[model samples]
Structure formats: structure tokens, C-alpha cells
Target: MKISEIKEILKGRMLCGEDRMDAVIVAGGAADLMEDVLAAAAKGCVLLTGVTTDHVIRTSKIVGVETIVIVRGKNPPKEFIEMAKSFEIPLMVTEYSLFVACGRLYMNGIRGLDGSW
Candidate 1:
């Protein structure tokens, strides 16, 4: 599903990158470890995490994740938002827990792309 669809279904707040919500998200990875994200996330994927650090943006850029969803109501730091803009990555803040959010997307038919990494 498109990022826009996920936003509407989850009632998520668009923290940034609203212009690219129509971007396709064939896969998603939820993690707090920037290293893991950088190592495992697919190109053009959406990242889901509760982390509010600037490293998240850096990691997203290195891994080519175009979208970020900050789960569990955690707001990203201002610096991170600016970094996201500089990197042209869209950011969203959601009240849903990581597990619930992933489940909702999965139930709605958002599947990972095979061998996309």
C-alpha cells in the first residue's frame, strides 16, 4: 500500500514529507537500532521506529528508506526533522504501538517485496 493509505488507515500525523506520501512502500522494518536499519532495510522502504534521535535520519538516508513512521507517540527531535527535510525523507508520527501498526498494515495487504534488499 501507499504511504498515504497507511496514514489514513492509522490516522497518523504527518510530521514531515507529506509531499511524498504517495510513495510506494512494498516493505517495512521496525527497529530502534540505526545500525540494523542501515544493514537490513531495503531501498525505498518505510522505516518504523519509536526512536526520536537524529541518527534515525542518517540511517534512513544511508539505507535509502524514503519514509519514517515514529510509533508509540514519540515525537522526533527538531534536528531530526530538519535532517529529514534535507534528506527528502517523509516523517510521520503515530500513536499506535509498533506491533499494532505493523499488524494493521499487514492485515490491510501491505507485503514486503521479495529479495528487495
Candidate 2:
């Protein structure tokens, strides 16, 4: 799926990296724990999380996540947004919970790193 499509599905607002809206997202994962995300997320996956911290941006960089959707209507901090922008990562926010966001992506044919439904 495209990053633009994921934004529409999740009803998210782009926080940065609008130029990357056309980027293809091959897989997705949702997690608040950076460790779990690193362990389970695939490279180039769109990460769905409620944690809006600098660590999230750092983790995304480390784990090769170029797109991130902050769930539960939480807005990311300015520092976090700046970090993501510096890394050229697309950051967005949605009102949906983590589960709902993940379900929407899954139903739209975005699979997990493990290729599970």
C-alpha cells in the first residue's frame, strides 16, 4: 500500500515528509515498545504506535521504519517531529487506537513482517 492510502485509511494528518506520500509500504507493525518494534518490524514497514517520543523516531531510524502513524489521537512532540524530518521519515497521527489502525491496514492487504493475516 502507498503511504497516502494508509493516511486516508487511518484518517491521519501528515506531520512531515509529504514528498514521501507515494512511498510503498510493504509491511506494517504496531507497538509502543521500541524493543518489540525492533524485534518484529520489517524494513520499510509503516509503524503504528501511540508513543510520541524522540525515542520512537530514534527507533524508527534504527529499525528502518520510514513511515510512522501515531495512534490514539496523540500528537508527537516538536523534537520528535524534527528528528523524523531530519531522517526524512514520514510522520502522521490518527485518532484511531493501535488495534483499529492495524486492523484497517491489514484488511487493506498490508501484512505483518511475519506474513501473518
Candidate 3:
């Protein structure tokens, strides 16, 4: 799925990297634990999480996440946004919970990194 379509599905607002809206997301993953995120091998995936720390942004970059969606209406700090921008990773926020956001994306045909059915 395209980042634009994920934004529409999650009703999220772009926090940065709007130019990357065309990026392709082959999968989705939701997690607050940075270790689990890294272990998920979420390359080219859209990550959904409630954690809005700079660490999250940094981890996403290292893991090659295509986008980061902050759930439950939480807004990432300016530093986090700036870091994501520098990495060319799109950041978005949604009013839904993490579970809901993941479910919506899954229902829309996005799969898990582990290829779960």
C-alpha cells in the first residue's frame, strides 16, 4: 500500500515528510518496544505505535521503516519530527488506538512483517 492510502485509512495527519506520501509500504507493524520493533525486521513497513520519543524515530531509521504513525492522538516532539525529516521518513498521527490503527491497515490488505494471515 501507498503511504497516502495508509494515511486515508488511519485518518492521520502528516507531521512531516509529506513528499514521501508516495512511498510503498509492503507491511505494517505495531509496537512500543523498540527491541521488538527491531526484531520484527520491518523494512519497508509502516510502523504504528503510541511511543513518540526520539528513540522511536532513530530506531525506525535503523530498521528502515517506511513511515511512523503515532497513535492515540499523541504528537511527536519537534526533535523527533526533525530527525524523521532528515531520514526522509514520513511521520503521522492518528486519533485511534494502536490496535485499531493496525486493524484498519490489516483490513485494508496490509500484512504483518512475519507474513501472518
Candidate 4:
């Protein structure tokens, strides 16, 4: 699936990287712990998280997450969004909780990076 498809699936709001919405999305991972995400996320993957902080963007940069979906209607700080923009990372806002978001993606054929990374 593509990131744009995810936006449509979740009715999410794109906060940045509008041009990147069509980027290919091969897989996804859900986690609030940046440490875990950094250790396991695949390259070019989408990160689903409830944590909204500057550290999230920093971790994403280090871990190679192309897009971030902030769950539960949470909004990252303005500075963090600006930072993500500067770094060319796409940010999305979804009202669905993390579990529901993950489930929806999975049900729609979005797999995790397990073993395929």
C-alpha cells in the first residue's frame, strides 16, 4: 500500500510532506517506545505511534522511518513538525487509536517487517 492509501483508509490528516503521501509503504510497526522502533523498524516503513515528541523525529531520522502516523488524535508539538519537515519526513494524524490503526492496516494487507527486513 501507499502512504496516500493509508491516509484515505484512516481518513487521516497530513501534517507535512504532502508530496510524499504517495510514497510506497511496504510495511508498518506500532510502538510508543522509540528505542524498540529504532532497533526493529525496516527501511522505508511507516511508524505508528502515540508518542509525539521531538525525540520521535530524531529517532525516526536515525532509524529510517519514512512516515509517521500519530495515533489517538495526538498532535506533535509544532517544533517537532517543523523539524520533521526540515528533515523531509512525512507526518500523519489519525483519530484511531494505535491498536485500531494497526489492525485496520493489517486487515487491509499491510504487513509487519518481521523476517522480511
Candidate 5:
């Protein structure tokens, strides 16, 4: 699915990388832990998380994440958004909790890295 579609699905607000909203995402993964993202996320997937840190943006870059969806309506720090913009990674936030965000994406046909949810 596309990042734009994800935004619509989750009622999300784009924080950065507006140009990247058209980017197509291959999969989705939800994790607050950076280690889980490194180990489980696929290249070009969307990452759903509650954690909003510069570390999250860094990990997303390393993992080739196409988008970062901050759950539970949390707003990340300005520096975090700046770092994401510098890395060319798209970032968004949703009012939905992590679980709901993940489920909505899954229900909309975005799957896990292995193509299973």
C-alpha cells in the first residue's frame, strides 16, 4: 500500500517528507523496540511505533523503512522530525494506538515482512 493510503486508513497527519506520501510500502511492522525493527522489518516497509526518538529515525534509515507512523497521537520532537527529513524518511502520526494502527494496515492488505500477519 502507499503511504498516503496509510494516512487515510489511520487518520494520520504527516509530519515530514510530504513528497514521500506517494511512496509505496511493501509491508508493515509495529514495535517500540529498535532491536525488533532491525531484526524484523523489511526494506520499504512502514514502521508503527509509540516511541518517538531520534534513535527511531536512525533505525528506520538503517532498516530502509519507507515510513514511520507514530501511534497514540504522540508528536515527536522537532529534532526527530528534522533528522527524519534529513534522512529522507517520511514520518506520520495517528490517533490510533499501535495495535489499532497495525491492525488497520493489516486489514487494508499491508502484511508482515514475510508476507504473513
Candidate 6:
């Protein structure tokens, strides 16, 4: 799914990299643990995470994640935003919990990293 579509589906607000709204998410997963994120998601993924840290951004960059959705309406610190900007990762804040965000994306036809939900 497109980042724009995911944003709409989750009723999210863009926090950074608005220019990347047209980018596509090839896979998706929800995880707060960076280890789980690394294992579960791959390149061009939409990551629904409750944790907002530079580690997440760095890991996402390493794995080529396409977007980061901070779940439960949480906001990241200014440093996080700056880091994401530097990495060119799109950041979005959503009111949905990690599970709901994942479900909504799945329902909308975004598959998991393994190609199944």
C-alpha cells in the first residue's frame, strides 16, 4: 500500500518526510522490540511501532523500511524527528494501537513480511 493510503487508513498525521507519501509499502508488521522488527519486517515495509527511538530509525534504515507509524497517538521527541529526516524515513503518528494499526493495514491488503498476515 502507499504511505498516503496507510496514513488515511490509520487516520495518521505526518510527522516527517511528507514527500514520501507516494512511496509504497511492500510488507508490514507491528513490533515494539527492535529485534522482532528486524526479524519480522524487510525492505519497503510499513512498521507499526509503539517505541519511538533513534534505534528504531537506524534499524529501519538498515532494513530499508519505508515508513514508521508511531502507534497509540504517541509523539516522538524532536531528536527522533531530526534523525528520521536525516534518514529520509517517513514518520506518522496514529491514534490506533499497534494491533489495530496492523489489522487495518492487513484488511486493506497489505501483507506481512512473509507475505501473509
lDDT of each: 0.83, 0.90, 0.90, 0.90, 0.91, 0.90
Regions of candidate 2 where Cα sits further than 4 Å from its true position: none
TM-score of 1: 0.90
Candidate 3 per-residue C-alpha lDDT over 2-110 given as tens digits, one digit per residue, 9 for 90 to 100:
9999999999999997998899998888899999898995689989999988889889999999999999998778888888899899999999998989889999999
Candidate 2 local lDDT, residue 33: 91
**Model 5 C-alpha lDDT per residue in residues 27-115, reported as the tens digit of each score:** 89989999999989988999999998888999999989999999999989999899999999999999999888888888989988765
Q: Enumerate residue pairs that collide in model 6.
A: none
Clashes of 6: 0
> Could you estimate the TM-score for every candidate?
0.90, 0.95, 0.96, 0.95, 0.96, 0.96
lDDT of 4 by residue, 1-117 (tens): 898999988889999999997799878998889989978898788999998888889999988898999999987789989999999999999999989999999889888978643
Error of 2 at 39 (Å): 0.8
| Model 5: lowest-lDDT 10 consecutive positions | 108-117
Best by lDDT, which number? Answer: 5
Q: Which stretches of candidate 1 lie over 4 Å from their true place?
A: 112-117
TM-score-better candidate, 3 vs 4: 3
Relative to the true structure, candidate 2 reaches a TM of 0.95
> For candidate 6, what is the lDDT?
0.90
Candidate 2 lDDT over residue span 71-106, tens digit each: 999877799889999999999999998898999999
**Candidate 5 residue-wise lDDT at 93:** 91
The whole-model C-alpha lDDT of candidate 2 against the native structure comes to: 0.90
User: What's model 4's lDDT at 68?
Assistant: 93
Candidate 6 per-residue lDDT, tens place, 1-117, comes to 799999999999999989989998888988888998778778888888999889999999988999999999997999999999999999999999888888899899998877664
